[model samples]
Target: MTEDYAALVRDDRVHTMLYRDPAIFDDEMERIFKQAWIWVGHDSELPGANSFKTAHVGRQPVIVTRDKAGAVHVLLNRCRHRAASVCERKKGKASVFVCPYHGWSYDVDGGLRKVPFADGYREPVDKADHSLIALRTECYNGMIFATFDDAIMPLAEWLGPARKWIDLFMKQGAGFGVKTLGEHRFRFPGNWKIQLENTTDAYHFPIVHKTFLSSLDEDTENLMDVLGQGGWVEDLGNGHSVMVMIPDLIDLEENLDAPIPDRFAALAAELAAEGHDDDQVRRIVRAVGGSGFNLNLFPNVACSMAFFRVLRPVAVNETEIQHIAIGMDGGPEAANRARLRLHEHFQGPMGFGTPDDAEGWERVQRGAAAGDALWVMLNRGVDAPDGRPEPGHEAGDVSAETGMRAAYQMWKRMMTA
Candidate 1:
């Protein structure tokens, strides 16, 4: 019998089985993660030729590498023979990957370079045909994504309306290119969708992060009032969404004349003392503070206000989340340091925000054990709407569940296809 995945995901709610059933989880791994453009790494992560990093597309481990010609390849980590993993390091510059089990080696582009004891085989092996499997990889702006399905649309077309928002989010680079400084990775007892929904759920910000708010200065606290701001959540087609928490900070290049906030005042003074002009100082400070919106791209990645949030599903009840800190590629040291400090304050494992959010998501998975008949309600802001979105996009107030609904609809589409 068919699973009827569409029936499980309605316009306003999804069945709790989505967070508890291993069968549904397995289906999602094949349907969505394998079929969709899964974000693998950023341009800065590879840096130059031979740079590589380990990543996952669903449960399949893969290696993201940049070849000598600067071409990026997402190769299956397993060797062509005996299925031994060719690489194990998280990231580094590597010209070749040698399987530990055997001396079989592959080039940075996953071309099988050599095999030990080749004479033992009855027939001569074709190196070209024995190369590691490679996924279709493409990048937009500085973000890289890979997919197993060759027939799916290009990353840009799949991104659709979200591309504009991605361009806006990149403005935080402050004229310099964006670079991934580092990341905070942690595993939580929850479904990946729970973390996905939380990225755009402004309604939980104040309640769940009350202590984080209290730790901020009064002015900073006021600025962090996401729901009270004239903000809105827009569904940016193909499961992507953007939650604008501070409209004033939408364009980091705009409002050059605005006074620097208290938290950034000292940094601004340091920049000025370093001989930076007024305009340059303001621009750097604003970039360090990050953008005002969270761009939640479908499946596994999100540009969450100031950082890149990537989710990896481990099981029906386990998810690994990575909060990647980004900074200007060649920007001033002071500005980059300020960005790191800010990331540490809220996104670090012991930071004021992450622990609390992790606990909340864990509780959600724990609560799922209570019943199988309940649904995960996602009807917020449906009856009463307050703001308009972009011309072709669907939107709701800042605290709405519009983003979650958009994601679930996409989930249903892929699962039922």
Candidate 2:
């Protein structure tokens, strides 16, 4: 078996083994996931002082919580005593975590707080040395990210050129922050990278999501016709990129008084009745509308439209996706309701879009299993208007493979680093 990771990713194509081989997946977990900053959860999930949620980073179970002091912390869920997870629930408000396997208790900051008995062994165990492992955590625009490698670059610098696009995506919330409405989780028999690439994959939308487009109003359907416009895909460094179609929707936060689109005709007067001013009405409308940029944030997250899609790799060929709907924090109640419906219509188990995408991923997995085709082609638009002025920035059409090439460029660098 060859361990040449470089040869797996070419300028125009990638090998199937990158998505199928168990060895390659494990290597990715170690090199890419552990070392890189991975998003865990949003700060909005922690509403109060003791709010906490469980997440995974590179196969390690983690607890993301706000301590009694109101500071956020990301601690390993594994108990030091018996290696059992201290936090069992997915999310809750807990002052401390108690290991079910043993009576060892830990504070929100993962400090060893108590044991069943203080004196049982001849040697006095040092509590300082038995603290739960904690990762370096940072929050940017309410998104929480953690890393096991302390030597990695600062989170702001690490996000690199991605910060601009992230700022643009957040503009849908219009000055106020966005909160997680809820999440829908589903597992597929495919590698996680399949979904990662799918986020910025504009080429598949017109083909795979044709049903979704057909159901939309003709005016709204026009939004999907960005393929012919001057729209372009951008490689935003550090494995991040965006397939942008509607540039006008990027920073509606600045133009709060912009009129609501025709799609929200039913909500305009209702918003007026709710005492919303013109600016606030526009803000609420944008929150309900959606973002045009499908912002893929490297290893784990895709801030797509109005939802946060997270990818978790469970095994070599198995992956789970968490689709979280986001709504403006203080927006009109009616607008938020419409936003939730929009998310459900597009992303949930019953949604029209996800089922089609899941089928696509499964087909790719099955085809790769044959080992007949060594290379998966990503050569679309390669001979067209492709521009790479720098190492981490590139430009091409909305349906171009610029994102995949740029992502793989960072992947190869990180894997071989």
Candidate 3:
């Protein structure tokens, strides 16, 4: 670690090089991401047997697949022969992954299936030693996570106090587990941790998204106040945290057919015609409307609004993010359509919010290299009126910097440990 690394992270501030230094970024990939339980894909993504999705765990390409026997596997994408990628597609159903370089193939369970032209081998090619490498995988609800360190704690245990929050989050899908409604992928010239910190950092919403809010139908003034109304930021331990909107003013269970908010009046008829009773309507709306808090699950996966923002670190100063919308798998088509629209309105590349965030993160990366400032402040709510200590953790106003402080505290732990 560089002298700047420790000097950068203090109790209330961090230095600029934390985001701009290539060497430091490499260290983070090894020390933090490699050992952490990273959310790779939702089980819903690989719905059928032999279904697979290509994903990353700490810069390593892996294939998360469901075998014919219904068991799930997280296998390295690298071919056992010549280091070529056996699977090329981002995701789809495949009986086996065939190496493009030499036709060496592996089954969905990651067993070496064939080596073309068998006579070419002099010795009995030790097939047992050459199957694709697999990482340990586990799931909670429908979300799947994988880790390179097989000895690390299981995913459920690792989620720590964040488990109940996951339960609360998945409830947005009601009894029907949420399914992916596709995604919008984009890259930003910024570090992945910057995006991670941004998710639970409610303090920036009012200032950074001011123009976006004012354009919406809701009362912009009170809209910002929603962050203050009943919400509190909480650190959920093990790098996970939440900006909880308690009493769930925005969640579905509370909103129901109670005269739809004026902003979503256009969506009311569609909700009604779905043939659901009032309570049913509420659940439908809540599930599809993506009524929940912002859940930052450590290294990746941010449950925000109608979508999950997934971050992939491509380089020291480059990050690729995916915006994934969710809705009940077997739910009404109209409600699902509405979910997709809402996801697009606020989160997609051309939407009301994401582009602005892109620019903001890029700005942070650029700014870090400019000045000689030794510390970037995360001291918004350190004491008194701004900060409120709670059981097992701390709390603050929705617009407070409590979440950033919590995330950094976790970051320091992972990067140091």
Q: Which ten residues in a row have the lowest lDDT in candidate 3?
A: 384-393
Model 1 C-alpha RMSD to native? 2.4
Candidate 1 per-residue C-alpha lDDT over 1-417 given as tens digits, one digit per residue, 9 for 90 to 100: 458898899888999999998899999999999999999999999989999999999999999999888899999999998999988899999899999998899999889999899999898789989999999999999899999999999999999989988999999899998999999999998999999999989989999999999999999999999987879988888898888999999999999899889899899999999999999999889888899999999999999889999999999999999999999999999999989998999996799999999999999999988886899999886653333443543335788898898899999999989
The models' CA-based lDDT, in order, is 0.91, 0.84, 0.78
Expressed as tens digits, the lDDT of each residue in 37-67 for candidate 3 is: 8889987899999899999998999999998
The count of residue-pair clashes in candidate 2 stands at 0
lDDT of 2 by residue, 1-417 (tens): 548889888888999898899999999999999999999998889988889999999898999999877788999999999899888898999988899977899998999998887689577768899989989999887889999999999999988888887877787665667888899899899998898889878878889999999989987888776564556677788888887777766766655566666889789879988888877777667667878778888889988878899999899889999999988787667887898888888887779899999999988898898874579888876654342233343334678887887788888999989
Q: For every model in order, what is the number of clashing pairs?
A: 0, 0, 0
Name every residue pair that clashes in candidate 2: none
> Candidate 2's C-alpha lDDT?
0.84
Model 1 lDDT, residue 224, Cα: 98
Candidate 2 RMSD computed on C-alpha atoms after optimal superposition onto the true structure? 2.9
